[model samples]
Target: MTKTALSHKSASPWLEDMRRRFRTLPFLKATGNTVFLFIFFYLYLYIQRNPVFEVTQIPATQLDRWIGFQPWALALYLSLWVYTTLPVALQPDLKQLTKYGLHIGLMCALSLLIFVFWPTSVSAAVGPREGGGMFAMMYAVDTNGNALPSLHVAAAVFSFMWLQTIFRSVRAPIWLRVVDALWCAGICYSTLAVKQHLLLDVIAGGALGAVAGWLSLRSAGRGKIAG
Candidate 1:
């Protein structure tokens, strides 16, 4: 019961609790993901703004014409931020959580590399959106040159693929799974409806996301075998 020992023993419960929570898997995963996102965003914005790389416009296919402009889809499109992060917070264990984080980081890195080598932009087919609102604001900041691999679509597809297993493990109802699929589908379509990406961009991004998700799951499976 030395003086310094007694003082340390009486440290505030609030501070102790905060420290404990920050050590949890969810908190650490979130912090790491946030940092990665910030760095990725900086690089992405830099590429978009760079004037040296010539922008290649992706042409619209017949399907792109059928999709049409649905300015309303913007809501679902932007929901990607939530959908992408929710699963990480709900992760059941540190081991699985780490795997998911690895997958996401790899996917983002691969996309960034592609953008550096081949700077592609959405075609002017849809032209400039004609009003002032959320959509307009998005257009203002979301410059061209990030097309070909639609990160938005990739994220939505990735979220859907990974979260499906989580939800099923929790015994969520069939209806919930159906809604999840629909939401992801909406996000994929939103990329086209708003003309932020062409049909080809969505396809390529989806393929990339699926591959990443598969590889991540495979790695987790191998870990279980080793254990």
Candidate 2:
């Protein structure tokens, strides 16, 4: 076979193996779902403990920290900001949708779970504060039970980390990755700038997203492509 055809065949075995395991490997098939369930179970038990919000602070007085533009932090936060889709858009397929859903569910559930033991703050300080357009609304609707995990940031970073899929599937340019990385930074800053979350919250969110994204992506198997 030619090099191109040989390469394709080489790739096909791994793809076939992954697809076959989807049936034989229940854990593989439902890794995302399993994660979602654990997170949900954790939250279910956690509520009995009753979470509370505590206080924390942003590091900078002049606005803009992340330890003065922490690289990964900036990339994760900005990618999330640019890529977040509106609720009304055309829905993704079941597999992709489930991944996204599980990511969100896991973040929110674990965050709430963590809060029961180690509560953190909604804002840097407890006070009457000026709020922005969505900020006030988010604050009002936001549960006082959990704020530290910054589920929004977690979800954002989850999607950002999935950027590789976009490139792999579409043959996207390298600049796209760079753009997504920049968005990650913006999303993190926006969390603090908009008063949605603190620095610690951003860190926790990024970490959670990283783990969940890794687990979800590792198990995503593709079916055959017609020649």
Candidate 3:
């Protein structure tokens, strides 16, 4: 009985120490960026839901259709970035939150502009015949509005190229960077597997994300975080 009591006492100190460490790192900052991100996400849904934003389906041409194949197909992949970035945003006062919000805002602004000016949609329509593929859950993703500048590919490309600097200061080793890279790569690939976006959209998204990520890292400061 005494041995059991002693073991409990011994671990209590370590557990308490861990608790203290965790308490230092909060989970959410709830800053302007947080509010803005929520607002923007809502606005995205609103734009899609509104009848004002019509879904314009594209006609299939031979060259454009062939984008479905390999070599070219590789560029279309983008799932991991979609899933992972939000989780990162959940972390507390990382400063990167604001940076991310800014980049995301730029994407949204660019997309919104495209939506307004070009006002186009994908040629492919996911209807009753549309398969229950990776994006099956998001089947509502019809060819109505929201087509130009694929946010998925853009975000992944943005994160991959930009966050490398941030991760370098992350205090992790080479293996961790490699793992993170794979995760980023997966995010890029997942976009296509899910079929939520097409090749043209992905390419545009990549460009936007890349530019945004670059600007974000630059604004985030010279790779040196205080405290």
Candidate 4:
């Protein structure tokens, strides 16, 4: 009986640490959210490409015209996937992970709903992806639909906001924040530069992302207070 009691006492700290680590696991939640959003995004693309929907081409504004076409921006545009995946490492707690996933899920849902009901396409001429290179591959997979509210921009904005919060929580350096901010801004501009979205689409996407980010943060705060 004395030996058993001593063994249990020695194991208690290990058990408690395991529990803490389990609660803080962010990769599973982030991966789950990523898969779900991608499937839904594919569905949105299908709906947009369907011939049954009345696809209205959104005309570019004067601002859109001013935003020159820069094919090199494709690198920055594709970097959004990497930017979004950073949360798996940066999220320090279950609360932060929850908020990040919720923000992305909500952002995708709202953007998809708009795409389904009010389908829009880009009117501006995007240079042909004819070389069968990286850009061609991207164009092949990424259908030209869901144009009004750029999900790319929305995702970038939502991701950066959550990342900012996470950085604050971890007391990350100011340089990290600056780099993140610059990256996010580059992603936003890349959308326009690549001709994937117009100026208005970017504006609306940014607004939606901001609202969703704000809501997610508010919800997380309330949860903390209630707890």
Among the numbered candidates, top TM-score falls to 1
**Off by more than 4 A, model 1:** 1-26, 222-227
Q: Model 4, stretches more than 4 Å misplaced? A: 1-27, 123-132, 222-227
lDDT of each: 0.76, 0.53, 0.54, 0.74
Candidate 2, residues 1-227, lDDT tens digits: the string is 89988867777543443333333435443554456547654664455235454333433333433223232342343444336541101112445555556555656666666766676555434234354454445445453335557766777777676654544444456786687677666776766655546566678788998888777666554221110
The 10-residue segment with the lowest total lDDT in model 4: 13-22
In every candidate, how many clashes are there? 0, 14, 15, 0
What would the TM-scores of all predictions be?
0.82, 0.55, 0.64, 0.79
- Ten residues in a row with the worst lDDT in model 1? 13-22
lDDT of 4 by residue, 43-70 (tens): 8768777735688888778887777777
By the lDDT metric, which is better: model 1 or model 2?
1
lDDT of 3: 0.54
| Candidate 1 vs 3: which has more TM-score | 1
Find the candidate with the highest lDDT and give its number. Answer: 1
Model 3 worst lDDT run, 10 consecutive residues: 67-76
Could you tell me how far off, in angstroms, the CA of residue 180 lies in candidate 2 after the best superposition? 1.8
Each candidate: RMSD to true structure?
Answer: 8.2, 9.8, 6.9, 6.9
